[model samples]
Target: MNIDFEINIYHEDYHNAGSASSEIKKYLTQLGLNPKFIRKIVISSYEAEMNIVIHSLGGKLKLDIIGNHIILTSIDKGPGIRDIKMALTEGFSTASKKVREMGFGAGMGLPNMKKNSDKFEIKSSPKGTIVRLSWVIE
Candidate 1:
């Protein structure tokens, strides 16, 4: 069976920062997913959600459970990343000072997301950005 879930994220929505991941965590738990796999998915989802809040105008996060793999896709609307390579680097962020003051922009979001996923891909342009992450269950 295949399952899919989607959540909308608004820019700078600190109030709902981790809600997407939290809800997904509950869903995975109810499905009896392995703890380690669920942890990775939750961590990556939180990072993606934060990225949308910190960077884009808004976005939607889609999670799909197909067979033994979980797929996550985040698509956001404008102001896109100027440098995809740099954005993936640790300690490199374009978040404003105000965002930094809130202790949310350490530039670790993308790196952490990639690190937690078995497979990761990112694409960006002047229009928007899209991030895809997938993990397999063993």
Candidate 2:
């Protein structure tokens, strides 16, 4: 079966930052996706979802399940990262003080997402940013 869906995410919407990932988890569970794959997928999805809330002006979290591949893509609008390399570093972050106070922004989001996915790709510009994570079911 193939599944595709998207959740719109707003800027600084901490209250709903995790909703997209949570919904994805429900679908994966209902589909009986492997537990090991679910864990990584959820992790990457959560991180990507959170990044949109914490950084971009607005964005959407998109999920696509095609055959044996599960992919999650976060596409955000405006104010892209100044330094992709630094952003991918384990301890680097540009999140605001309020976000840090909210117990996020410890700077592990990108690295964690990358580590948990079978394939990861990112593209950014002043106009927007996109992070794509893919996992395969064995």
Candidate 3:
């Protein structure tokens, strides 16, 4: 079975940050994905969504579910990552003070997403940023 979804991003919208992930989780549950896989997908998707909301002015999230695998793509039109290596680290952040005050700027988003996904790739430039995360269910 295959499933696909897309979500819009808005600036400073923490309230709607996890909406896309929630929709994806609902779809995965209806499709009968195992509990463990569903949790992994939800966590990774939420991380990706939060990154877009915190780092970018606006963007979109795309999800593709293929059989036992889930693929998530997050694209943003922001300042882009200056250092992919540093961004992937566990405790590096470029978030603003306001974002930090919200208790969400610990910089664990990318690292946690990578940890939960079977495959992760990040591409960024002055133009924008694109992140792809994939997980395989047993």
Which scores better on lDDT, 2 or 3?
Answer: 2
Q: Which 10-residue window of candidate 1 scores lowest in summed lDDT?
A: 129-138
Assess each prediction's global lDDT (C-alpha) against the native: 0.91, 0.91, 0.87
Question: Higher lDDT: candidate 1 or 3?
Answer: 1
lDDT of 3 by residue, 1-138 (tens): 687879998767988878988988888798786889789878988888898888887899998878877789999997799999999999999888988999988989999899988999999997889999988866
C-alpha TM-score for every candidate:
0.96, 0.96, 0.94
Best by lDDT: 1
What root-mean-square deviation over C-alphas does model 3 reach? 1.2
| For model 3, the run of ten residues with the poorest summed lDDT | 3-12
The regions of model 3 sitting more than 4 angstroms off are none
> How many residue pairs clash in all the candidates, one count each?
0, 0, 0
TM for candidate 3 is 0.94
Ranking by lDDT: 1, 2, 3
